[model samples]
Target: MRSPTPPDEPRFVLAARHMVETGQWLLPHRGSELYAEKPPTFMWIQAGTYKLLGSWNLSFLLPSLLAALLTLWLTWDMARRLWNPRVARYAVLALFVTLQFGLMAKRAQIDMVLVGMTTLALWGLVRHLLLGPSWGALALAAFAAGVGTVTKGVGFLPLLMLVPWVIWRWRHPQAAGPGRSWKWWLLLPAFLAGTAVWLAPLGIALLQNPDPALQSYAKELLFKQTGTRYANAWHHHQPFWYYLQVMFTLWVPGSLLFPWLVPAWWRRCRRADPRYLLLLGWALLVLVFFSASPGKREVYILPMLPALAVAAAPLLPGLLRRTGVRWVLMLYALLLSLATLVVGYGAVHGDGWAQRNAVKRAIDPWVLPQVGWWLIGFAVATLLVIAVLRLRRAGLAVVLTTVLLWCMYGLGAMPALDPYSSASRVMDQVRERIGPDAELGMVAWREQNLLQTWPQATDFGFKRPVAGQWEDAARWVAQAPERRWLFVLDKVMSPCADRSQVIDIGSANRNNWQLLPGTALQADCVARTHGVVDDADAALQDDGD
Candidate 1:
C-alpha cells in the first residue's frame, strides 16, 4: 500500500473506483469528465478485480500481473507446438527477461492485457493456419481479436497474421489452413461476438439514453479515439524510426542478440521454413503497422515482443554459445550495474546529480538516501554475480541481474517514491492542514488528486479551461470562507491569490501544489484568472466604453 499508482495508472484506477462506487460499469469517468480515450474493457476488469479483492491497492495491479503470466504461458505452449520443449522454455525466458515486457507487467495499464489477448489470438491462428485446418481454432482466434479490439483499438493487430499466412500458403499449396468451406463466414460473427461482450451493452445504453453527452461520448470513443487519434495524433508525435530505436534500447539483452539473430532468421526464411516465415513475417507487420503512425510510445509496439521471442527461441541456445554474443551480454550487465552504483553513491553522499534528480522527480530528501543505499547494495551483489559467472554464463547472469534489479526497485525504491509520485503525501498534508471538518475543493486538478482523496473532495472538472475552473473554484470557496479550502496547482493559480495566505505544500509529480484559503482571494480576482484579460486591460476597455 505504500506505493501509489503511477502516471496513467491512477486514471484507470479512478475510473474503476467510480464504477464500483456508482454501479456504472458501462461508462467510465475521470474526475468530472467522461474518459473517452479508450474503451471500457480494461476498466471493467480492474473494477471486477476491486470487487473481488475489496482492497484497492492489492487488487489494482492484479489483472496486469495475471495477464502477463497468461501471455508467457501461451508463448511457451505455442513455441513448443511449433518447435520443441527446449525452444518453448527459452521462448518464455526470453519474453520474461525482456525489459519492456517485465516493466509493463507490474503496472496497472491496459497494454499488458491487450498483449495477452493478442498473443492468444496469434497462438490460435498459428495452431489452425499452420498446424491444422481446425475450424474451432479459427473461430477462437477471431473471437480473441474481437475481445482485443474492445480492450484497445489496436487489439486486432493479431488478425494481421492472415497476411503472412496467405503469403506462405501461396508459396506452398500444401500448407495447412481452414480450407474452402461455407463455415468460414462464421469467423466474422465470432469476432463480432467478442466485441459485443462490451460494445453490445454500450450500444444498448446509448440507444436507450439518447442524452447528448452520452451521444458525444460514443462518437468520441468510437471515432475520435480510434480513427482520428491514429490517423492524426495530437500528442506524442515522433519520427517514423522511433520504434526502431525502442527495439534496440527497451528490448534490451534480447535485442542485443538481434545482430546475430537477423541473419539466422533470413537464412531460415530463404530455406522456406514456414515457422520462421509466419512468425517473423507477423512481427515485421506489427512493427510496420505501428511505425506508420506519427504518434508513438514505447508500449505501443509491445505486442511484437512475443512473436519475436518465439522466433528467436530456437536460435538463442546456439547464439549464447558464441563468444562475441557472450561478451556483449556481459558488457551490458556490467554497464547497468555500474550505472546504478554511481547513482546510489551520489545520492548517499548528497552529490549534485542526486540533488538535481531529487528535484526533477520530486523525491523526498530522506527517502533518496534510503533508496540510494538499496541501489548501492544491489549493484555490489550484481557485480559479484557477473564476476562469478564470467563469460561462460553471461546469459544466465544477465537474466538474473535484470530480474534482481526489478525486484529491488519494486521492493526497495517504489515505496520511497510512492508518496510523492502518487500524490498521497500532498493529499495527506491537505487533509491535515484543513482538518477533518473543512470542505476541500480542487481546481485544475489531475486524476491523482481526485483519486487519492475520493468522495471527500470536490473537483471543478478535469478538462475545464484553467480560467473557468479557477472562477468556479474561487466562487465555491467564497461562499464559505471559514470552513472551505481550495487546493490549486501552482501553474493555474490566479495572480490575485494572495501569496501570504496560500501555503506551499511542496512539489509532487513535477508540479508545485498549494493549499489556498478564501482569505487569499483579492478584490480583483475575478478579472485575473488565466487565459483572460487582466485587470488593467479590463479597466482600459471599461474607460473607453
Candidate 2:
C-alpha cells in the first residue's frame, strides 16, 4: 500500500547506494550480461528507500516486504469474495508462512515486487469485473496494473487473465457492470499503456548504457538461464515434473492437501463458480508460460502461490470438522517447535559465530540454519496464531499478521546469514596470506562480482568473472605466489598437493552462495575455493594476455 521503510545501515546496501555514490548506471557489471541484471524496478525502489533511511540494504527489502503484506491483505479480501472467507484466511497464511515466497518477498530480487504488483492487479481486476466495474474500483485496478508492469516484465501477463472477464465487461457493460458505460474499453488499453509507461524508462536506461556485459546478461536472464544447454541433462534442465516437485518443497505444510484439492476445486468451479476456474487457470497459465520459456526454476511458480493457498480454504474447514481444529493446530505447533530448535542450534553451534564472522562476505546468505531457534519461534507464533483462530474465531487477519511477521523476520536475518557461510568468510581469511601489490589472478573459475565483499575489489572495479580457457586460468593461479593474492572458485586450482601446499577456507559455498537452494547438505559444490596453485606457472584458462 505504501513504500517500505528505509534500512538504517548504508554501507551494507549494494547496488542502489552504488547508483547514488558512483552516479553510475546499474547496467555495468562483472560478467556476461546475457543473463539479466538490471535492478530496473528494484533499484528504483531501493533508491527511494535509500533516500528515506539514509541506508540501502534493509531499505531495499522494505518495499517488497510491504508489497507482500499488501498482497496478503488483498488475497484475503479476494478469497472471501471469490470463494469463501476460509479460503481468504488460508491464502494469506500460505503466502506469508510458506518459506519460499516468504524468503523471496524479503529479498533484493525483483520477483517479490512482481508477485505483489501482479496480485494487486488481479485483485482489482476481479473486483471490477465481478462487481460491475465501479469507477473507484477501476481507478484502483488501473493504478495497480501500472505499478505491476513498471516493476517487472512478467507483470503484463496477468492482464491476459482478465481477457475472459474483459469480454464480459465490455460487450455487456450497460447490462453487466455497475459503471455500465463503454468504460470497460479503457481497462485493457490502460493495462497495456501502463506496461509501456513503466517499461519505457528501463528500456531507455539500458539502451543508454549498452555495454557488452549487459548484452551477455540479457542472453542469460532472457535465454540461457531459462533452460539447460545440455538439453536432457537434469543438472541444468529439470523433468516436466519440476512444478510437481516444487509444490512439495515450496508449498511446505499446505502441499499435504494441495493435490487432492485441485480436482475438487475444478468441480466446484464448474459453473458452481467460474472464479475457481479463474484461479486454477491463473496458476495453469503461469505453468505453461514458464514451461514454454527457456528458463525454469522452482521459484518461478511462486506467482501463483496466493491463488493456490486461497483455493485450499475449502479443505481446511473439512480438516477442522473431521480431525478437530485442535489437532490441526497441534500439528502446526509441533512443526513450529521443531523448526525453532533447528534454527537455534545452527545459530550457536554452526561454524563462524564466535569470531564475529557472521557475514564472511557482503552478499552470501548461508547462515547456519539456526533451525532450532526457528522451530521454537514458530512454536510460540503458531500457538498464538492457533489460539486466535480457535478461541476468538479470529478472521483471516490473524493468520495474515502472523505470517507477515515471520516473513519479515526471516528477510532481515538472511543478510546476517550470508556473510558467515559464503565467499565473504573465505575472503576474510585468505586476503591476509598474499603480499600487497601481488597480481591477483583467478583460477579455473572466477566470480567477478559474486565474491564482491566489503573491502573487496572496487579499486579494480567490476571485471568479467568467467574464464574462457582452463589453461589460462591455471596459469593465473600458478603465477599467483609472485607476491600477489588471489581468490578463485574451483578446487582445480588446488589439484597438485605436492607442488604447492594450499589451504581451504570458508568451507563450501558459491558466489551468491546463499541463493542456492537445497537442504542443509555438507555442500559439495556451491562454495569452497582452494588457496594455492598446483604449478607455479600452471594455467586453468589462458587469455593469451
State which candidate has the highest lDDT.
Answer: 1
For 1-545, candidate 2 gives per-residue lDDT tens digits of 11121121121234455555566544423322211433345665776787788854357668777878877888899888876776777667666666687767655566777788778777776777665455556656666666665565456556666655554446445554455468766776666666555355546756887776555655644343223321322233565667878888766656655555766786776653546655666677877766664445676677788877766665666654544443443465445554554555555465434223435333233434443345345556655665666533433433543464465366444444544433344555555454344444433333322334444442222223232222333343344334433344444433332223344444433332111001211122212333333342333222110
With candidate 2 superimposed using the best TM-score fit, by how many Å does residue 150's alpha carbon deviate from the native? 5.7
lDDT of 2 at 80: 85
Tens digits of per-residue lDDT for model 1, 307-402: 999999999999999999999999998998999999999888878687798878677688878989988988998999998999999989988998
Query: The CA-based lDDT of model 2 is what?
Result: 0.52
Model 2 stretches astray by more than 4 angstroms: 1-14, 26-28, 31-39, 80-91, 135-150, 163-175, 178-189, 202-236, 292-295, 311-319, 324-329, 332-418, 430-452, 455-484, 490-505, 508-545
TM-scores of the models, in the given order?
A: 0.95, 0.66
State in Å the error of residue 465, model 1.
0.7
